[model samples]
Target: MTAAPSLDSKYYEAARPRSLGERLTGAARQRIHADFLRLCRPGPETTILDVGVSDVINDAANGLERHYPYPHRITAVGLGAAEAFRAAFPSVAYRQVAADCRLPFADGSFGIATSNAVLEHVGSPENQRLLLAEMARVARTVFVTVPHRFFPVEHHTAIPLLHYTDAGFRWACRRLGKEEWAQQQNLILMSRRRLAALVPPGRTARLGRTGLPLGPFSSNLFLLLTP
Candidate 1:
C-alpha cells in the first residue's frame, strides 16, 4: 500500500501565501467582506458557519469576526485540534473537525455556510461531494470560494508545472516532495465543475467573480446556492 502523504502543517502556514495582499489591503479586505455579505446575505436573523478555519498564523478566522457586520453569531470549524481553535477565537464558538470527513453538526442546523479556498484541499471526489452535501444539508444557503484552475502561478502546489493543468499541479507537488498528496489534483479540478450539482436539483448555481479583470476567470471563484 502507498504510504499516506505527510504535509508539513507549520511549513504550509509559514510559506508566503497568495492571499497576503487581500489580508493586508484595507480596500481589498473591504471588498472581500462585502462580497461575503452579498453572497451569504446574512441578516440579524442569519447564522453563519465557517468551515475549515485554522487558528495558526494568518488564519482566515483571525479577522473574520471583524470583517463581517456584527449582530450575528458565527461558528468556525477547523482541521486543527478543536482546543486550538477555541484558544484562538476565545469568545467565539468553534469546532475542530477533519476537512474531508463528516461535519459534526445536526442536519439543517444553520442559515448560511461559507468556505474560502477550502474545497481544493479536501482531496477526494467522494469526500468533496460529502463536504458539499453536508454544507447544503445544514445551511439554507452555501457559499464556496476556490482558485480558478486558470489562475496563473497563484501558488505552488504538489504539481511541478504551474499552469493549472492536472499534470502541472502533480508535477509541482512532486517537486515539493509531496507526490502522495499531489494526486489530490483530481479533487481540485473536480471541485471546479462538480459544485454546481451540490444544490437542490432544481436550484441553479450562482457564480460570482472576485471583481478583478485580469481574465474572464479570476483567481478567485465564488459560488452561492440555495434551495
Candidate 2:
C-alpha cells in the first residue's frame, strides 16, 4: 500500500501562514511562483495587474512581487493600506481597492491579471464572480488561485474535518470562540466545480492544481482564463 501525504497541522495555514507555517508557505509559494511563470509565460514587457495583495509585510506575503523580475511592470491592488506593501516592493505600483467593487482600471489595460489565495475571502459567491469578472475585464488573461476546499486542512481558521461542511465549520468555530471566522463575511472555500461555475458564460477557463500536489489533495487550485 502507498503512504498518503502527511499534512501536519502546525503548517496547515497555506493561505496566510504564521510561524512554523511560514516555512511550509515559503516553499509552497516558491513553487507557485515558478508554476505561474511557466504556465502564464509573461514577457518582460507584459504588464501585470495583481489583485488582492496583502498589507502584511512578511517575506511570504507576495510571491509575484518577490519573484517577478520586472517589478515596474506590476501594479498591485488590495483592501489595505499600500504603505507597507509599497515599502516591500518599491518599484511595483500599489493601489488600495475594495474587495467586491470593479477594479479601478480601464478595459484591456493589462496583459495579465493575477491573484493568489484571495478568492475565498471576498464574501459571497456573487462577490467571488465579480472579482473574476473584474480581472477578466481589465486584462486579456486572468490567473487567480484559491486554496482547495478539500485540501484536508481549513486555511483561515486552521481546523480540520469539521470545516469540510459550512454549518459544522461555523459551529466548531463558535465553540472555539473564533466568532469572526464563524461569519460568512470572512471566508468561502472553493472547489473546481464552484470555481468553473464562477467564470462568465462566454469565457474560456482552464483549471489546475499546484503547490504541495498530493494529486486531488493539492494545497492550491488555479484558474487560467484567456481571451
Candidate 3:
C-alpha cells in the first residue's frame, strides 16, 4: 500500500493556526471534543484517554486542555517511534502503543476515550473491531471520526479522482492506469450504521453526528458515543 503523504506539514500549517484560533474562540479540538464537553460534562476532576496519538509537537491533549476545562489528566498512546510527542507534552503523561489493534488498558479506566481518524488506518475490519472494543472497554465514552466513504481517497491528498461506486471506483481506477490505488490496504471506509455496531447497544448512545467541511461540500463525519 502506498503511504499517504505527511498530513503533518500541509495540514499543520493550515489547520494549526485555525485550531489555535478555535481554542482562542472556544471551538475545543474539533466538533467531537465540543460534543464531548457537552456529553461527558468534563470537570477539572475528569481524565481522558487519547488513542493513536501522532508524533506531532503540539498534541491534541494540550489543545484540549487549553480549550476545555483543564487540570484534567490526558493519557495519549500511539504507534509512532518519535520522542516529539513526549517532548511536546512534558507536563502530561505519554506512552507508545501499537495502533494495529489491541489497547493495553483496564476496563473503565477513563472517563473518555477518543480516536480521531485512527480506525481507517487500522488495516482491517477485525483490527478495527479490536481497537473499538478496546476503546469501549477502557472508557465509558468513545469518540471517533473518519473521512466519509463518499469522499474519494485521492481527495484526501487534494487530488480529486472521479466519483465512482465502491467496485466501480476500483475498476475505473484500473482502467485509468491506477489499479494499485485500489488495494484495500488501510483506511477502511465504514458507514455510520456499521460504526454504531462496534460498541454495546445498551451502554452506547450517539452524542452528535455531523459533517464538517474538508473542502467545500466534502467533509468528514465526527461521532461521539457513550459506552
Highest lDDT scorer: 2
Over 158-226, each residue of candidate 1 has an lDDT whose tens digit, in order, gives: 232274666776776667775654556333552346655544464457976653334554546678877
Ranking by lDDT: 2, 1, 3
Q: Estimate the TM-score of every prediction.
A: 0.75, 0.89, 0.71
Q: Flag regions of model 3 displaced more than 4 Å.
A: 1-29, 58-72, 151-155, 159-164, 168-181, 200-202, 211-218
Candidates, ranked, TM-score: 2, 1, 3
Error of 2 at 118 (Å): 1.3
Q: Per model, how many backbone clashes are there?
A: 9, 0, 0
Question: Candidates' lDDT values, in order?
Answer: 0.59, 0.77, 0.57
Q: For model 1, where is the 10-residue window of minimal lDDT?
A: 1-10
Candidate 3 worst ten-residue window by lDDT: 1-10
Candidate 1: the clashing residue pairs are 158-172, 158-173, 159-169, 159-170, 159-171, 159-172, 159-173, 160-171, 160-172
Best of the candidates, TM-score: 2
Against the hidden true structure, what lDDT does model 2 obtain? 0.77
Per-residue alpha-carbon lDDT of model 3 for 33-56, expressed as tens digits? 565576668677777887766564
TM-score computed on alpha carbons, candidate 2: 0.89
